[model samples]
Target chain A: MLERLSDKWVTLVLTGLASGPRRYSDLSRRIAGVSQKMLTQTLRGLERDGLVRRTVTPSVPVRVDYELTPLGESLMPLVAAIKGWAEANIQTVEAARKTYDAA
Target chain B: MLERLSDKWVTLVLTGLASGPRRYSDLSRRIAGVSQKMLTQTLRGLERDGLVRRTVTPSVPVRVDYELTPLGESLMPLVAAIKGWAEANIQTVEAARKTYDAA
Candidate 1:
């Protein structure tokens, strides 16, 4: 369960969608290092979890966009908090690691 | 990195220590299904990351206790929110999974 949250791409993808809906190509472009396959899988998982809403608009070319649902939006602050904590403590953590390794 | 946050045991161990300090054995017991090796590794990682404080008491039989640091405590709310979100949406995710799988 928590494993899904840990997926390397999930956070980035969710954070990307937090701003607004993005087309598949746009999301793929925005999140660096995310491969097409992984993005698809991550989006599928989020969609399956009901955290992301997917819309397909038929046209000369089908336009598909991904956006966060309220459930997914609810996760934003938690995600942000976690990110903030990590950023704030990363230096300390690195120092501790060095000390621990030396000892 | 976010990967550490997603660690299967980190959340459980951090949550376990949030209330107060506990001996190694106590933590091992409190979080069911955590193997000795994994618990030890998790604690070492948390300790290295400066999230957990390890105290070794010199005695005929030395006792070691683990507790959360301020940094670790800061993570509690974020961790709790993640746990809460997962719990609240598990059923919906399951339902979505079924729908997704069927289509």
Candidate 2:
């Protein structure tokens, strides 16, 4: 499970779901640039790990919604902290990159 | 940089560095289960990205030390928060796991 969440797409998917339950297509739309295959694979992995719940309802064309489980919801604060940390230190990291490249 | 930090070993290495500067061998030891190849690779990646500093002292047996750069140290609080969040909600996750398994 720990190993599973370490992927870039997984983190992005989780961040997208942090907003609310999203259908498969909506998730693919919300996270720009992820391939359909990758999005589906990541979502299944999250579901298998018990981090996400997938609900399928009979509709005109089968409506499906994916939402954070308790386990997944519990991870939100940590994700937010990490995102906040990244935003806070991006300046220093960029400056360091410039310095490193100059060196 | 964000893409790079999303790896499991990167997170583990950053957590290990959160303690203090450590030699390559010490980091391998401190992390308590990372493969030598993975550790070296992850450290090299961090160094390349300027998130970590590598210091070498010339001697009969040359000593090399690695530590968090300012940007790396900046991630400590976030790492701590994530780890702390995981620790705090472990029970909830576990319970969720049981419920999930039973279902």
Candidate 3:
């Protein structure tokens, strides 16, 4: 569970869906650098975990959208906090790594 | 950064040190399933990230203790929340997975 939550792609995919439902292409574009296989796997994991819902719309071309389940939504504040901490402290962490490596 | 923060070993190690400094042996014992190599790696990663401090005491066996830095302490509430959420919702998640798999 921790592994799944901490996964980089999982973080990205959850964040992408936080605002609203998104098509796979939208997520693939928003999360830059995520491979198709990884995105699919992450979505599947999230769906299985009951944190995400996958909706399929039948049209000329089938449309699949992913959105957060209530459980997933409840987790957003925590996820956002983690993301905020990472963004704010990444520089400090990088400097620490450099200093540690030099020692 | 999210990956590091979300890591299962990282969570366990940080939680183990949440109260105060602990010896490697103590942490190894506290975090039941963690291997020695993984514990060492997690501690090193935390140290490098500036979230943990390692003190070496010159003793017969060179006593080593690990404690959270201010930054690490700051992260505890978040980690605690995640831990709480996981414990509370794990059964629900398991049920969801079982249902998903059966369908």
Per-model DockQ: 0.71, 0.37, 0.70
List model 2 lDDT by residue over B1-103, tens digit each.
Answer: 7655546688889988888899988888878779999899888778877789999999769999999988788777766665676677667666766776677
Per-residue lDDT tens digits for candidate 3, residues A1-103, read 7677667788889989999999989999999899999999999999999999999999869999999999999888888777777788778889998999999
Listed in order, each prediction's TM-score against the native is 0.90, 0.72, 0.85
TM-score of chain B, candidate 2?
0.77
- For chain B alone, what TM-score does every candidate structure achieve against the true structure? 0.92, 0.77, 0.87
Best-fitting candidate, measured by lDDT? 3
Higher-ranked by TM-score: 1 or 3: 1
Compared with the true structure, all predictions reach lDDT values of: 0.86, 0.80, 0.88
Each model's backbone clash number = 0, 0, 0
Those runs of model 2 whose alpha carbons end farther than 4 Å from true positions after fitting are: A3-6, A87-103, B1-12, B28-38, B85-103
DockQ of 3: 0.70
Give stretches of model 1 more than 4 Å off.
none
Please estimate how well model 3 matches the true structure, expressed as its whole-model Cα lDDT. 0.88
In candidate 3, stretches whose alpha carbon ends up further than 4 angstroms from where it belongs are B33-35, B59-61
**Docking category of candidate 3:** medium
- Please tell me which model should have the higher DockQ, number 1 or number 3: 1
